[model samples]
Target: MEELILTIVKPLVDYPEDVKILVNEDEGRITYQLSVHKEDMGKVIGKQGRVAKSIRTVVYAAAGSTQQKKVFLEIID
Candidate 1:
């Protein structure tokens, strides 16, 4: 899951090395905190949050097979 988020975000940022993803799992829920260089925030989030929504949708779909677990994505500056 961490790798997936990294793969998706690295290409969108000017500083790929600055992209960081932290995963926390508890109580059957998985939370992913994604932090990128400040300049790349807009690229990851996109206009009006469309890109962020798309990223979340993909994550949800990928986790659909594991219905017992819930996935959450947080994009941090």
Candidate 2:
């Protein structure tokens, strides 16, 4: 899951090396906290959060066939 998020986000940022993902699991819920270079935040999020929403949708669909845990995405600055 970490690698999946990285693969999706790295190319969208100016500082690919600064992109990071932290995963947390609690009570059957999985949360992916993504952090990128401050300047690249806008790129990852895109206009009106469409990019972020799209990313989350992709991740959700990818995880659909796996365990039935809830998934959450957080883009942190």
Candidate 3:
């Protein structure tokens, strides 16, 4: 999962090394917190959050097929 996120985001950022993800699981849910360099925030999020929404959609679809737990992806600074 982390790899998928990295693959998707790293190319869009100026500071690939700054990209990070934190995983938290509780109550049958898994949350992935994705953080990127501040300068790349706009690129990852895109206009009106479309890119973020698209990323989340892909992550959710991928997780739905392979995991029983509800999965979420959050983009953060």
Top model by TM-score, which number?
Answer: 3
Which ten contiguous residues of candidate 3 have the minimum total lDDT? Answer: 1-10
CA RMSD (A), model 3 = 0.6
Q: Weakest 10 consecutive residues, lDDT, candidate 2?
A: 59-68
Write model 2 residue lDDT over 1-77, tens digit each, in one string. Answer: 77788899998899999998888999989999999999999999999999999999988888887858988999997
Error of 3 at 51 (Å): 0.6
Report the lDDT tens digits of candidate 3 across residue range 1-77: 88998999899889999999999999999999999989999999999999999999888989999999999999877
Clashes of 3: 0
lDDT of 2: 0.91
lDDT of 3 at 32: 96
Instruction: Name the lDDT value of residue 65 in candidate 1.
Output: 76
Which RMSD values do the candidates have, in order? Answer: 1.2, 0.8, 0.6
State, as a TM-score between 0 and 1, how close model 2 is to the true structure.
Answer: 0.95
Q: Cα deviation in Å at residue 17, candidate 3? A: 0.4
Error of 1 at 55 (Å): 0.8
TM-score of every prediction relative to native: 0.92, 0.95, 0.96
In Å, residue 46's CA in model 3 sits off its true spot by: 0.4
